[model samples]
Target: MAGPVHPARGVSYPVTALFMVGVFLLGAAFIASYVGGLHAPHPHRVPVAVAGPADATARVDAALRREGDAFDLRTYPTTASARQAIQHRDVYGAYLPQQGRLLITSAFGPTTSGLLRSAFAPVAAADGLRLSVQDVVPADPGDPEGLVPFYLVIGWIVSAYLVAAIVGLYRGMAAITLRDALVRLAAFAVYSAVAGAMGTLIVETGYGYLPDSPWPLTGVGALCVFAVAAATAAAESLLGIIGTALTILVFVVLGNPSAGGPWPLPLLPAFWRTAGPWLPNWAGTEAVRNAVYFDGHALTRPLLVLAAYAAAGIVLFLLLAGRTNPVMRFPAHSTA
Candidate 1:
């Protein structure tokens, strides 16, 4: 006789096939979105501070306008304010026509600095002058592409989600008490500290890719890791396995591409640019840049953003503890 026909084989086979197809589609979509979003970046109303006499400012503004809304030009009374604006992150670069100089912060990302340079070069050329480029905040030599901070943030985010997945797996296997949730959170805190230190050392000390003092970066990294991890834990606690997928969808798929790390915010399309500051990846990235290059200038916004995420995560985790799956529920009469 032929081998016994499996009772559920027909149904199982089709379900498995469909599941694999879904996985394929997910991968395809991820690739397409990332590639399409970043393949070619053009500036859109990139803020630039210009300091010069009235006639010179008018001339420069007219020239920039001809470039089709490529720059949002603002006139500063003096070069000092222009430099301050760049340091404050109000502008990516500045033009001082009196000195015929272009001020940039490579810490903003080399690609953005280059774009600013090219955009203003012709204006200077038209006046029979060569633009003097001044790097107010140069990127560390070891990180010429200025992507180490972004990679560090990405690493922290990955670790956070993975730890959340593991915690979720345990929750699936058995009920988790409030005390158990606290223990898991404490463990994540320790992990965040260790991961932050290790990442700071690797990038700042080992590779010399970040010139900032290691302590601030370490602290920021710790906060970032904790924020992501706590947020993931809260997600998993509230949503179960689906929460893990949501974490990936939010942090990885949506957050990473719009992060403004590889390309500064000005170069990104409108949606991503608008969303970048609201995301953890961009917040962490900008905080790191400020710590390393701008002497922590304009660090408040990004730090506040990270802090908000961390706070919300902790609150959510506490609220959701002991309230999820019955398998993780505490027995009604048990004190423990």
Candidate 2:
């Protein structure tokens, strides 16, 4: 007969609390980066499109200048041309001569759009121009406020290292065998597929948890999941528990805020802004955006980076696993 086991009999409360504290610290780091990046002020040097005759263009440019140093105004022949500029991200906003309609972009961040709005005010006031705003490339309805992509990528990042930590806790510090490596790789593949599907569902459905995707959204999600998982697994293979924390700090804390998600890269401080592209989160976010809005044109470089990480991780795992390093053994106590 088996004795009844209390719920907490085998668990150490202190260890659990300590581990929770560490996780909390990681969460705090993420919050600090997200909120800190948001609170830190930035001035926008957004490009603007002014469409009209040369005289009208010059007139609008001068009026915009009076509004302050906000816009880098350029002249365009027509509103269509200006729209193209905004789509290409060459300009943040556009103005049409007919009825003085204002074409604002969500392609850029709110701060950049706000700068354009400010610059247009003086121009409108000077010329008695009536203003109308339009979003040429609107954010997905499912992703209202344009935060779904960021959150989705963040979730994948969390899951990746969460799995690594769980595995590490059970397995301890041991080099992976080739079979073990293959199993983990297979697990990553499955997880990525599920993550991709869930991401797509959240974006497409009115779940209110994620944004909308146009096309190839699932593929983007899969790649993002794979990148995060591969990197986390590699880190754990290399540095054990410490590497898990570093993964969170690097991807969630520093990388998320620096990514051109809530704020465009130009709006972040130079240090975080510069660091964004090199990290996994940035690669995923950029790829998501490319799939959703940019017709997948801008995803090549970031995808390449992720693929490199995956390949390097596999190779390193194989090499490490093949070695038979000596194990320390302790003698059993003798009962006299």
Candidate 3:
């Protein structure tokens, strides 16, 4: 007789396999995100406007062509048109021949601009031209160094999310239903308004750090806060305790360092640049800059992205909430 053949003890092989698969997926996610973030930008398809008189146009076009993979050059008859293109989102930048100046309006990461600036230098010299720099859309005065509005918005986002997370823990993730989700979101809106008002007031009147209309800042701040809180609530609803870690993974660890706040996206290493725009951190930063510096230009895309995140979170929380374990669920909490 064969010795007692004990069936597999503890976890079954299939269960172990499933567990391994989950681990693999998570690991893959981290690797893919991390590597994608670092991948080098080849200056592929970067739009630029070139403007000058007939001869100047031709010369500028030639120089831009020689500049290679970096520039997708478009020609304009006058500098005003180029500026218009930039303001209208037609181009990231424009070069003016008569003034020998380059106009930048887009809030591209700093590294990309630095690269362009340096590249323009050699080309300008070789072509017997001089270079001057102009920022059609400048940053806010109070924004610390390169990251002013970025950090401010980040602060608001973190606070709101912290509130949501705390509420979830204390109250227990509620038996969130469709109505409940909407109510939560509605509550989020009110909380957002308060947070935004306070943050904006502090930054503008309280500290005099930002020189801009306080109302606009407050409005934008409210939107940002809502987005973050909604997102946190949704994440907590989905992942239970793991949601907090995931939040750190997405918004803080990945979001902050990669946020174009301190160095601008381009100035960051390749990985950070690629991942920056996809995260709420980048969206919030861009939106803040648009409201304060870019004359409200270039804000639509980022705002839409943030709105999408908020909408998605609300939908997820409402739809799948019934399946959640009440004991493990996140109720009203503070993420601040």
Candidate 4:
């Protein structure tokens, strides 16, 4: 009733079945990563400044540590010095005992600022001082929660993978020539630039957010997009469709929830906080945030990280391009 089986078709069934199993594992890991990572985020080592003498600062530190290893307290001799530390991005908030004030930068993230308020309220009460709050570097009124930069970074990342998907599918992921790789890399660069510019334009116009920062934002977006796309392309060159899925596992499932977008790093659990800065998702988000909010302070490291990814991808694709992934090959075998 059934036709004779072709050697190639019968030989590759195991590979197809393995791919399905991989998909199932990926789905399980996605749930474990997102829900498990984000379910109950509390502060870990939030750095904050306190303006007072050594004895006074020690007392405050003792109080905070009693709660948990939540706040990493830094002491400054005066309120002015503490405020300077915040502006320099050395600390998130500063408490001035004499002034009875809590100076915070909501621009870092409203969640951090809120945590500072709650943590200091009891301290202020114990000191018999009424706490008055001041936002030193507040979020832009247009972007209240300071999430525009994160969303923009997410857009760049999504566009990058899409570019890889389209180009890899067109050029045949199972096999690529040197010329095909070069052309795909060139296309990635051009698409990244256009996508970055258009993304910047839309965000600037629609939300009226991140004014006076189009050029730097575009640069960040382009670099982020290119970094992701090139790496994805390289992966496809090596492993075919499985490589694409690997990037999703690395960049999406692991990177996004740990990116510190919804909250700052201090507010996340230890594992996510530790992994945040190393990922492209976090770098892109912080680069855009710095470009818009902090006058581009501490931006070099993130740029370097992105450039490294781009460089590594280019190198790998050039080396591996023309080689057929063994997993993708279905060779005929003779029956005994």
Best by TM-score: 4
Model 4, range 33-133, lDDT digits (tens) per residue?
88877888788878899998777777788889877888899999888899888776778999986656899988866788889999888888888888899
**What TM-score would every model get versus the actual structure?**
0.89, 0.77, 0.74, 0.90
Give the clash total for candidate 1.
1
Q: What residue pairs are clashing in model 2?
A: 142-211, 143-211
Give me candidate 1's TM-score against the actual structure. Answer: 0.89
Better of 2 and 4 by TM-score: 4
Candidate 1, which segments miss by more than 4 Å at Cα? Answer: 1-22, 173-175, 326-336
Over 163-198, each residue of candidate 2 has an lDDT whose tens digit, in order, gives: 656765555433457787777778778888788787
Off by over 4 Å in 2: 1-32, 52-78, 97-99, 107-112, 172-175, 206-215, 322-336
lDDT of 1: 0.81
Best by lDDT: 4
lDDT of 1 by residue, 112-175 (tens): 8899889888888888889899998788777778888899899988887797788677554222
CA RMSD of each candidate after superposition: 5.6, 5.1, 8.3, 4.1
**TM-score-based ranking, best first?**
4, 1, 2, 3
Query: Which residue window of length 10 is worst by lDDT in model 1?
Result: 327-336
Error of 3 at 329 (Å): 7.9
